[model samples]
Target: MKKIYFFLTLVFTGIQVQAQKDFQGMAVYESKTQAPKFEGMRANRDITPEMQKNMEERMKQMLEKTFILNFDKSSSIYKEEEKLDAPGQQGGMRIMMNSFMGGGGTFYKDVKAKTYTVDKEFMGKEFLVVDSLPKLNWKLEQETKQIGGYTCYKATAVKEASKTDFRNLRPKNNDDKKPEDKKEDPKKTSGETKTNFQDNFELPKEIVITAWYSPEIPINQGPENYWGLPGLILEVNDGRTTILCSKIVLNAKDKATIKAPTKGKVISQKDYDETVIKKMEEFREMNRGRDGGPVMIRR
Candidate 1:
């Protein structure tokens, strides 16, 4: 009860302070995902421990990333910070991660308008995905914590897992279930959702997101596709991954001007996802060897 009262007082003071200023803030975030483990492959003697270690290291380097969020009162732009790949080594893993995870380009959201426009680069083509901001039914919890010197409160929501993102993604291995799910799989002994070739595939129906937000910031903005909180979400844990704000510049001298992308074919998010799936299927066919394999399917 005391925490709630203090939080509300901060929010009121924040609104007053914000109203007097041209309020723009920049926040730096560290994002990381739990790379799916291949239990079946680990059990195989042919796959060495060294090979597994190397693979894990590669994924860690790719999945662990930095992002910047620039925001005002009711609008924000979230994007990955620029980083150089090793010389002559095109970031294949990073590129695939971007395309497969529906990441890349700027993610701009307008809270007042209830709209969001995002850019997606996939398979040598760019797409401008224009869609209404997803409405999340956020349930505010009384629990509070501190993040980067700011008091933060906990809130949770159950979102319909997006098919466009990596979380709900699973390769359709010529069947509704994964290779390990079928009895015909040579390596299958148990019904665990694990495959040797497909280390990253899980079909979760919903995404439960727990966010820690600070009301002192006083903005309905969050990292990535999450928003509509009473404050700026400083940390988000969506089961398989977590995004945490490391630093914040409330009002910097050189503010980033938020702008929507002008390039690429304008399409709704649904159509863009369908396009991605269709292109992926075609790509799979072209590269299909005698030892045929898996492709993505729509939810």
Candidate 2:
């Protein structure tokens, strides 16, 4: 009986030691809102008719875009470890994004740059950029918080918003409101709803974003346009909707290869957004429907 109890204690200690080892992972980000003030827009139940009309007109000309970021777990190295692939790590990470008006999606490839050897100049660099304009930042803050079963940390970062062009959108006119046409089609008789999207004018104030990272699996990566947290960003709230990392996996048996996408030309993050908007406007114009150009979808 004494021998059995000792064996059990030894096994538990071994498990704890293994859990302390650094790990690699991939997390998916799901952003619910396009802009910071979207919630306020939703709450405005007392909007006036003219104000509503203008909002609707603007929505017709706006472009919608989404971005996803993938990270390379195999590119990471631990302080006390050598430079070699861990048990089940792989190549790199990829992010996928889509634009509504612009007819496209973007994939970020090879986010983990080539790992450096031990005792080299760039030894402790955490974040790496494999494609697109390079971005490098580190994971900091040592405190831990519970995220699922793994312990995560509170991490903060300031990243510039991707630059997208809001200029020269497809011009659209309010739909003709003839009484005869309205009476003829009961289903389409209702007036269009409007929304005042604040995408134009001055750039938004520098965003202060916060996220939770997990140290249980030591890879400093996350999904959809964010990385560099000490642990993976389990939840990110940037004064908008909260993007929680619903699930995370580390060192699974089958390793997934992370690679850069060669589909679109590599441009600066800002330029990329702008180009997508411009392309969307062009697409709208080219395929304007039978009702004379792009009909104002809202007001």
Candidate 3:
């Protein structure tokens, strides 16, 4: 009787574990970013209140976006829910920004493998960026909150900020200075430097990202490049941007295809970053002029 009971317990435990591994779900996220607010504009010195309001409204419409995450126990696929482009955004610049900043591609994460793959489309070219996933040292906190009826615990991480992140983009303080007023650098070997890439591409060295995850889901996954949590991350605040979970469905019959992209020019993440930087510098040189006008649009 004792041996029979032991065998039955083992069978029941295996079934329970198998049930946990079979859990699959789909999560929808709402991501948004704030418009650039200059100090001069607030004082109405650089622009009128009416103009500022219109600018903000237009940018808000462009920045508000949505994403979807399909996940099982060990791997997940994240991608933006396709939407029509905003007016005046049907250009190379917008597409490049999206491709570079984790927007234009289908992102696939293999938690067990500790790797990620992104199928990015930039400026009419395709790239399959594959690299090890970012290892975030999540500092779990005692604080908890409710999101979409699930209790979520708080966690924070300090990670290196991307240089190409659109939030870092802003007009330089001396952008309106006259060409005559600017001094030339004698040490620059590339003859007369048309534009200074270093001065214009400033960004925070690091950013503190706060996340809220729910243990009820028991899945270590999140939207975009965010993961490595004890549970499913429902919300994330990265200073200038926020991605929040709006809805979730568990074990849906129509499971999303959670596979890594198989086509494109294969490149590591580091090489891709360097490629983007090089192209941006080249563009600046091409558009630079003697009139001291903007080589790149502020918006």
Candidate 4:
């Protein structure tokens, strides 16, 4: 009886230690965005081959990024790894280009609590967008692949156009007019103007998202707004961009410090998106009548 009791106690203690070890870890993900060619924009511009190459490289540098996901069993904090610019390199057009691309943000997800928070910056202002985790109707597939030595299973879902994606669809302003600056015209009333903008600016209805998850790492966590899977997502491709796990360190000597972002204007995700659109419209209005202004590049 004493020998059996001792064995059971050892097994239970080992299970407890393993469970604790499974939840605390960090993952490194590399994101690559395959932006469409700017052939239409270059058609009218006097862009030399060298200049085109340089521009493309700069754009790639901006889009291709690395992120770290520090996670426990039920919560995770994902943040971009900052890249230092080359010495004396100016961010002239690249900065403007990034504003249109609209992505870099820190995301926090709590699966247990069904909550999420995003630390986003727009036009030099920080916004803490808090909201519930988006529920995805993922269709599990029989397909399997290995990512960073982990056997990952395939899952897919459809989601609405993200705020970054919506920014790309903003219609060009005919003329920058402040709401207070313009007098009411019979032919072009406020309602008509709004209708015209809505006609021109159509948001994408659905975005196909493909994710590969590993059951071995049994954590329902992923980068950005993706979650609710039965396992840890190792790779995700949402049409325009792909984020893949390059490295995962489990049970390290030092645990990653995962915390929700506290500083920024508190707002819901919907409100934050509206704020972005409003600011973008204001920028268009301010840049009205300016020659050689920022051109929208379709990707």
| Local accuracy of candidate 4 as per-residue lDDT tens digits, 71-184 | 998789998787777765576554555546655567889998999987766777877889999899999999998887889999999888766453335443436668786666
Which residue segments of model 2 deviate by more than 4 Å?
Answer: 1-29, 34-72, 75-97, 100-106, 109-139, 165-203, 265-271, 277-299
lDDT of 4 at 116: 90
lDDT of 3 by residue, 1-299 (tens): 99999999999999989887777999999988765543222222456767767766655665777889999999999888887766765556556557545577789999999999998876577889999999999999999999999999999999998765656454456566799977764534433223443344456678899999999998899988889988999999986789999999999877677899988999998887888778877876775552443222232
What are the C-alpha RMSDs, in order, of all predicted structures? 8.0, 15.3, 6.7, 7.5
Q: Candidate 2 versus the native: TM-score?
A: 0.46
Which model is ahead, 1 or 4, in terms of lDDT?
Answer: 1
RMSD of 3: 6.7
- Candidate 4: which stretches are off by over 4 Å? 2-18, 40-48, 91-102, 166-203, 294-299
What's each prediction's TM-score?
0.79, 0.46, 0.79, 0.78
| Model 3 error, position 79 (Å) | 0.5
Indicate whether candidate 1 or candidate 2 has the larger TM-score.
Answer: 1
Position 164, candidate 3: lDDT? 58
Ranking by TM-score: 3, 1, 4, 2
TM-score of 4: 0.78
Count clashing residue pairs per candidate: 0, 19, 0, 0
Model 1 per-residue lDDT at 218 = 87
Give residue 263's lDDT in candidate 2 (0 to 100).
Answer: 37
Better structure of 1 and 2 per lDDT? 1
